[model samples]
Target chain A: MAYELYYWPTIQGRGEFVRLALEEAGADYIDVARESEGIAVMMRMMDHAEHPPLAPPFLKDGDTIIGQTAAILLYLGARHGLAPKDPAGGLWTHQIQLTIADLVAEAHDTHHPVGVGLYYEDQKAEALRRSDEFCENRIPKFLTWFDTILARNPAGDAHLVGRSLTYADLSLFQLVEGLSYAFPKATGRALKQAPRVAALHDAVARRPRIKAYCASPRRIPFNQEGIFRRYPELDR
Target chain B: MAYELYYWPTIQGRGEFVRLALEEAGADYIDVARESEGIAVMMRMMDHAEHPPLAPPFLKDGDTIIGQTAAILLYLGARHGLAPKDPAGGLWTHQIQLTIADLVAEAHDTHHPVGVGLYYEDQKAEALRRSDEFCENRIPKFLTWFDTILARNPAGDAHLVGRSLTYADLSLFQLVEGLSYAFPKATGRALKQAPRVAALHDAVARRPRIKAYCASPRRIPFNQEGIFRRYPELDR
Candidate 1:
């Protein structure tokens, strides 16, 4: 049976990370919420599944339901050879992915600094302050960390772990994409400072599957509603 | 060989989750940063370790170093039988852990709503708004999810994953501890609404090893400096 992926239908949010993994693995799956009446199905699953996911971006594989993007990737990565087979290498890859998730959360908070309950307009002042620190400190810091890891990878600078294309690499590509879209000026400068990370992003984009996926309708475009919104004022 | 646990020496923060697992398992481990000159070693390790952790609360067992609180527990949980032997059961435990980590991150952000670079006083206005939403919505939503999962567990309601104690149970206990410390009024009210979750917290506290560890100095007291802080103004 094809795997069922439940996430918000409109934007490349956290679900995009899982989508990249599934697409890269060439795994058979359905983006459940994007289909007609699928949002209802997704909500019902969240409400009544034997194992409920606190939020979307969950995967249902047969009787098993896996939530949390990193946990979902951890499940898919091992099964799809997208992570190292060895115990230590797999954990390291997972650690990197968790760090990426942290950065993504921080990015989301740039706009919703006061609370997610309020609109962007209601929290604009706080967002400005939060985004400044994010652009000045968090982005550079996270990018530098990714660059350091890429440069220090014993196998090669091209991959995050074991000279293989792990899900960390895919997620990093998505991170860079979202950051650049959200904060073009800041991320552009950070990318220049972290050339290896920039190169890795380009390399992942060149992957036949990822490249095709980006062009296809299946890949949602960046928007104001998603985690990485391109609010020009906040970007600056 | 004794395991080396690296984290901020003064605060329970994220490291407490790992410490709880280690203590409950009766594992011999060194709290590296709490020792004299240990913080220097911890910083240097982060600066130069092959698998560099973006931040602390990393564990080193001989040559293997694992970072990310949830990832560290994933490693320790399996070896200590704090998690199930089955792959599906293990992933379920990890999924719950990842969700708990998400709540922990949100709890930290309530005080640092503007940015971590700024002190809580500097972000007091934003913190108040954020904390209001956190107490009024996020906490209840998260606690209800935990309560629902506990109620729905097929094996029993006592454990988060299976019949036996898993790291998720321990982490959930720690989460309740932090929230209660940070927002006594709100958390107390929320706990009353989540009786199963409340009972689990009390049960974990009374466990022989965990009970002793809490009494021991090895368990740091919750203070204003940690992720969960008690600011009466912000709490209300």
Candidate 2:
């Protein structure tokens, strides 16, 4: 059976991480929300009393439902040989994935600083302050940390863990990609100080499969509705 | 070597989740920040790292440094037999853990609705609006979803997953505890509609290890600095 993925139809959001892994592995999967009846089916599945997902961006494999971006990616990675085979290596990969998840949450909060429910316009002042902190303090703090990891890696800076393509590397690429889209000025500034991380992001983007996915319609565009949003005031 | 846990010295915060799992499993570990030289050591460690963790509540196991609450729990759970051994069961446990992580993040945002660096007093107005949406919309939605999961459990609602204990159950207990601490009025209102969830929280609390931990000095009290804080105005 084809793996079924459920997420918001409009934005890449958290679902894109899972989509990237699936796409890279050449796995047979259905992007459920993209189909005509998919969103309703996804919502109905969520409404089920038995085995309801805690939220969207959930993956359905036969009868099993898994949510959480990192969890979904971990499952897909392990099932389709995208993660490290060694136990320690796999755990380290997960460790990196979870940290990326933290970065994603913080990135989302930059725009919705006042409240997730409030419009960005309503929270513009707070968002501006938050985004300033993110760009000046948090972004460099996080990116530099990843850069340090890459520098210290025994397997070289090509991949996040060991010497292979783990989901962590893929995620770092996506993270840099999203940050570049949402906060190009800030990202560009930080990228100057994070050479190893920048190199990895460039390398991941150049992968044939990933390059195709990025150019294809299956890969959604980044927008204000997504986690990483572009606000001129916030970026500045 | 004993596991070394690093976090802020005072509040339970995210470290409490890791502490709970370690305590429940009877694992040999040290809460580094709470010890005599702990905070200094944590700071030095952070400064010395080529790849410092993005933030606190990280764990050090010999040479490996792991961060992120759920990821730490996942590692410890798998290593010490706290999680389900089966592939499907383990994936489900992670799904629940990630959802709980989401709830924790939302709970934290209720008070710091504007910016993490600013004082709660600075963001009181925005927090009030955020708290209202959280209390009226998010809290019920999340709690009721857990209630549905409990009601739909094929093995019974005694535990969150199978009939046995899982890290997700412990996390749910902590979630309910934090919610109750941070928003007694709102949580009280929500719990009335989620009897099974309440019951599960109580049951987990009543476990010998957990009960003892709650009553002991090891269990840090929730404070304004922590993720969950008591602000009566926000609750109402």
Candidate 3:
């Protein structure tokens, strides 16, 4: 059976992580929220009393409902043989993915620092400060950390964990891509100093599957409603 | 060799999750930062050019270094035979743990909405609004979801995923306990409606190992420095 992915219909938010993996692996999956009457079906699934996902970007495989981007990716990666086969390598890949999830959360908080329910206009001042910190410290700190991992990898910088493509690499690529879209100025400055990480992002984007997915309409564009938003004030 | 845990010495922060797993399993480990000259050693270790942890709350088993709270728990849980034996059960357990991690991150952001490096005093206005949203909406939303999970557990409400105790239950106990301490008014209001979640928290705490840990000095007291801070102004 094909996996059912439920996320916000209009945004490439956290759900994009799952979409990327499924796309890269050429897996059979349905983007539920993008279809007609899909959002209502997704909301109904969430409102279910039993085994409902805590939030969106949940993947349904048969009776199993999995949420959390890292968890969903881990499930898809393991099932589709996208993660490392070695136990230690697999665990390391998961660790990196979780860290990426942390980065994603931080990125989202930049605009909604005062309240997720509040508009960016309502929380502009708070977002200004949050984004300043994110651009000045958090982004570099997280990006450099990924760079250090790639530098330390015994299998070389071609991938995050080992010699082949892992979900971590794909996620990192997405992370950098999102940052570049949302905080172009800050990302450009940071990426210059983070050569290895920049190289990895470029490599992942150049992957045949990822490139095809990027060019396809199936890959939704980033927007204000997404985790990473291109607000000029937040970028600088 | 004993397991080595590296985190900041003062707060019952993210490190507490790993601490609970270790304490519950009676695993031989050292809280590196609490030991002699340990904080400096942790700083130095973090500064290492090769194989350094991206952030704190990392575990070192001989030469292997694993970071990320959920990742660390997954490692220790499997290693100590605390995780479910079945792959499906294990993945479900991890799914819940990742959700807990998400809640923890949101909780932390309530108090430090403007910037992590900034003091609460520096961002009081932003925090006030953030905390209000967190207390009024996020807390109830997260707790009610967990309550629903417990109520719908196919095996039983005795555990989150199955009939047996899992690390997710322990983490949830810590989450509720922290929420109670940090946002008593909001938590009190929510718990009244989330009886199953409250009951699960109480049940997890009543476990001999967990009860003992709670009573022990090893369980650091939650304070303003931690993720969940008790800010009277923020709570109401």
Candidate 4:
């Protein structure tokens, strides 16, 4: 059976991270919410699955319903040669993935600072302040950290973990892409400060499978509805 | 060799989750930063280690330096028998740990909505508003999810992942403990709706090793500087 991935149909959001890894590996998986009965299957899992997932962007492979984007990638990474097999290498790769998660959450909070359910207009002032601080402080801090990691990677800066690409590399590509889309001007400045990181993003984009996926309709464009929302007022 | 755990000495913060795991498993570990020269070791790793950790609360076992509280727990969980042996069970355990991390971050944000570097006094207005939404919407949503997971657990409601104790149980205990201290009124009310979660918190506390650790000077008191800071105005 093809792996079942449940996420919102319209927004790439957290699901994009998992999708990128699956795409990069050319894994057989269904973007369930995009399927004919995807939404219903997702709803049933949310409502009544034996091991109900805490949220969407969960992967269902047989009996397991894996939630948390990082966890799903971690599961897939080992199986697909996208993660290290050695214990220490695996742990280091996971540590990097968790940091990427932190960056993603902060990106989401830049737009929805006060409340997730509230409209951006309702939290406009807070969102603006949050976004400004995020662009100035958080973006540089996180990007610089990643740049440092890449610089210090004994294997090479081409991949985050070891010689080959791992889920962390895929996730970092999505992070840069989302940040670049969400805050074009600020991301450009940050990219200049972290050239190696910029190079890695380019490298991941150039991967044949990744290149094909980017051009395919399967990859959703950044919009106001997703985590990396482009609000003119919030981003300078 | 004793695991070297490096974190800020004063605050329980994220490190406490790791401490709780180490304590519960009867694992020999050194709280590196709590020692006189501990801060320097942690600073050196941040500044100059070959694989510099993104932040503190990193664990040094032999040569591997693991960062991110959840990542640290994931590494220790298996070795200490604090996590499951099976692949699916381990993944599920880790998924719960990641969700607990989400809750911890939200708790931190409730007090620092505007900027992390800024003092809570500087961002009191925004913190007040953020905490209100957090306490009302986010807290209930997260707690209710945990409650449902516990209710639906086939192993037992006594633990988050399986019949055996996991690092997730230790972290959830700290979460409930922090919430109770920081938002007594709101947490008191939230606990009423999540009796199973509340029970797990109580059960973890009563564990002999955990009980001794809490009673000893090892367990730091909850303070304003930590993730679950008490600001009377924000809590109510």
Q: Which candidate number would show the highest lDDT if scored against the true structure? A: 1
Q: Rank the candidates by DockQ, best first.
A: 1, 3, 4, 2
Candidate 4 lDDT, tens digit per residue, A1-236? 78889999999899999999889888899998898988998999888865677788899888789999999999999989999899888888998899999989999888778777788888788888888889898888999989998888899888888899999998999999999989998989999999989999999999999999999999898888999988877776
What fnat does each of the candidate structures reach?
0.86, 0.71, 0.80, 0.72
Better of 1 and 3 by TM-score: 1
Interface RMSD, candidates in the order listed: 0.6, 2.1, 1.3, 1.2
Candidate 3, residues A144-220, lDDT tens digits: the string is 88888888888898888888988999899999999999999999999988899999999888889899999999988
True contacts kept of 2: 0.71
Cα lDDT computed for each candidate against the true fold? 0.95, 0.87, 0.88, 0.88
- How high is each candidate's TM-score? 0.99, 0.96, 0.97, 0.98
Predicted candidate 4, C-alpha RMSD: 1.1
How badly does each model clash, as a count of residue pairs?
Answer: 0, 0, 0, 0
lDDT of 1 at B188: 89
| TM-score of chain A considered alone, across all candidate predictions | 0.99, 0.97, 0.98, 0.98
**Model 4 TM-score, 2 decimals:** 0.98
On residues B113-225, what C-alpha lDDT tens digit does candidate 2 reach at each position?
A: 65677798887877887788899888998999888888888999888888888888899999999999999998999999999999999999999999998999999988888
Off by over 4 Å in 4: none
Worst 10 residues of 1 chain A by lDDT: A109-118
- Give the per-residue lDDT digits (tens) of candidate 1, residues B20-135: 99999999999999999999999999999888999999999999989999999999999999999999999999999999999999999999998889898899999999999999
